[model samples]
Target: MTSDDAAQPCPMPNAHRRLMDCHAQWHRLHEVYFDPHEFRLTMNSLVQNLRNVTWLLQKQKAQLVGFDEWYLRFQQSSGSNEIMRWIVKSRNRITKEADLELLSELQVVWHQDWLQRTIGTSSKYPPRMSIREITNDVMRRYRPPFGTMTVRRRWVDKALPAWELLDATSEAYTRLEELLAEGHSAAAVPMCDLEAHDRECVTSSLRASGTRPHCMVDAKDDLEAHFDLVEGVEIESTSLVIERDEELIAKSVERYGSRAEIPTSGPIDAVPGFMANARQLMETDGEHGTFVFLYRGDALIKMGGLLFYNQNSKILAFEKLASQVKAMNADGVLVIAESWFARPTKKEEELGTVFFPARDRLDRMEALTVYAATRDGKTAGQISLVTRDASGRAICAEPDDMDDAVVNTLAPILRIWAEMDSSTN
Candidate 1:
């Protein structure tokens, strides 16, 4: 062995001072037997191993403590594995201790936002976000950096191989995986236990009726159900330490002791801005005008309400409106017609030509927003549009085809906006 292979003591501190002194004793024993430099390198490797193991163990514990009601519910049910997939993708990506806290807070925020939208303020208690919405939000918020393989491809090429390597090299990683699987099973345990109890109750009831033969079958089924619940049950880890989330703050000390506080003061007041924009667009005659709002990430959230104008206006006006909408990050359009013409109106044809290009064309339109207009001068049959489906995909319906029923229902809405023209004046 070369002189450069001399053993250097592991310099990092430990909790116990006595343990730290053990290094000197070890070096004395190995002084004549082993290459000192190789021993130093091994010590470095052991220190790194300890750090990596500690990180994984701490992460597992935090996840357990941080598991909110929504996440627990997600673990219990079967559906799109989007959240699991996201969690898998996010594995090994978080660097600091604070990231776990951030993730927990984000989960709570996502759940609360969904509840407010779905059940509104009428709900007695805060509700969790649906799996689908939470998954989409995660996908939007924690998008992979540019040039990374897509999620599907990465799962096959990178994630799977990494897991295999982890299992082979690190006992800590394998233990973490086992703990996670056990937690999932634990989440599912309550439901299974409930089913088993119910079956056992039925079995007892049947036996009381003197139907021994049928009861035997039920009794066996009940036993099997009970066994299923117990088969993979694991003791919850006591060593896992949970980091406290700082974002949840006290709104009131009396009624609601604590609530998840959003970082912002409150939800954005978009209506007033949208109305101002709509008014400006309607009053202007020649200039191209648009008001854009991002609802999610960088994409425009879906909204309702149609702007109406006289049909005699130049085709360029419609073209300009379509162009402005298309330029923004929007997926679909809605067009409202005041009257049911037997065939497509000139404006509809023009909008269709601009908004919905042939599927094969080089500039083929991906999606278009719908528009509405009032043809009948009477207040009863004005154009209208509304936001009906909050959860559905945004659409790009062609204006050329107006549904008779839709026109009948939305026409009254156009009448309500008749005062808009006078207000503009």
Candidate 2:
């Protein structure tokens, strides 16, 4: 039927009407990717190998592998190759994972809209136009960021201590920071910390993982802001290293009642900061690239260890850790990595499979600062973002709590390096 006809009420059988409705729902639904925006950006930037693989599979018999398959392969590949296609793949997988998280966000938004207009004014529930409220309304209680579950009634009282939305935000923020700090400190000594946090979550809230709460890079360091830069978008080293830092103070929990007391430090640093030497730089055109250099204490350990723990700890698993640079129809490329402060190999231990427009991109940008581990409680590892004179423009960075104007000063330094695979094709 035509558009007009489809909208018109028809004297069709009830069965026929139901079938058409179902058909229309499926046809109108967005089945491309769970998150259309991210999917589009990532997929559009697919490397040649990925593009080729995708096309080949699409043409023949190729089933897009799930997260695990792509992950193991991705971890094993070279840094350059790993960065290009593998990172995209892993992110795609995470996209699938964060579905629940995203759903939670959506539900909250819906609740606000529903409650704001009707809650207080209506004889029944009040209206709330915010997602948090909507989510709270429906779920009654959700787990905290630490991934700890909570009882609905208890969550409402504990999370909404004062029963005010403002308090809810403040509470959540404080708890989130504390949770992340605990992870960095590895302070789950009694093992009840995570469980306690879990127990505290409201039933309406989604279970939050207290172990290592998800972070949005420099979470607390933000000035209430948040990306579109394809121009000088360079792809440098994507190294995944697990190391044994001297400052690491993780005492063996096995010594429950032993004479040796548990050492003081932190839980673990999922993405801890550490400084490495600088890359070969070019004083002329500001064409600088960066890579992570391994340090003396930076021994490559398996990922599942305390310092750099991942459920799957095998180092050999990430064979795709080193990625290669492939040809692209874009502008200047860049790769910047602030690694373990230790140099792993004599010759860029893991050379990129793909070359840039210029070799200088790899040798250019050096690390300015790193997150140094420390045995001193007063000097525990910190989150630091430093910049060098790669562009001769003195780059100043304020603490994350600083104002926006102060923080935005260090906007992403867009420097283009070389082309890839020789433009002549």
Top candidate on lDDT is 1
lDDT of 2 by residue, 1-425 (tens): 22332232221122122222322222122122234354334333322223232233233223222423433343343234312333344345545543211111121111111112111111122221232343334444432221111111111112112222111222222233232223222322211211111222211121122211122111211111100011211112123343334433234222211223212222112112221111112212233233222111223212211111221111111111211111111121112323222223334546733233221354442223222221111112222233456646423233121111111101111100122232122
Compose the digit string of candidate 1's lDDT tens values, residues 1-425: 11223322212112111121222222322231123344334333322342343334344444443345433543443133322333333333332221211100112111111012111111211123332344344445543322111111000113223221111122222222233334434444211111112222221011111111222221211110100111222111111011122332121222333233322211122222223333233323212222222122222333322232322111212222332232221222223222222233477577763332233345333222223233223111112222213654323222232243233222323322332333223
Which regions of candidate 1 are displaced past 4 Å? 1-79, 86-279, 290-425
TM-score of 1: 0.20
Q: How many steric overlaps are in each model, in order?
A: 13, 92
Candidate 1 Cα deviation (angstroms), residue 282: 4.0
lDDT of each: 0.25, 0.23
Runs in model 2 deviating more than 4 A are 1-170, 173-212, 215-425
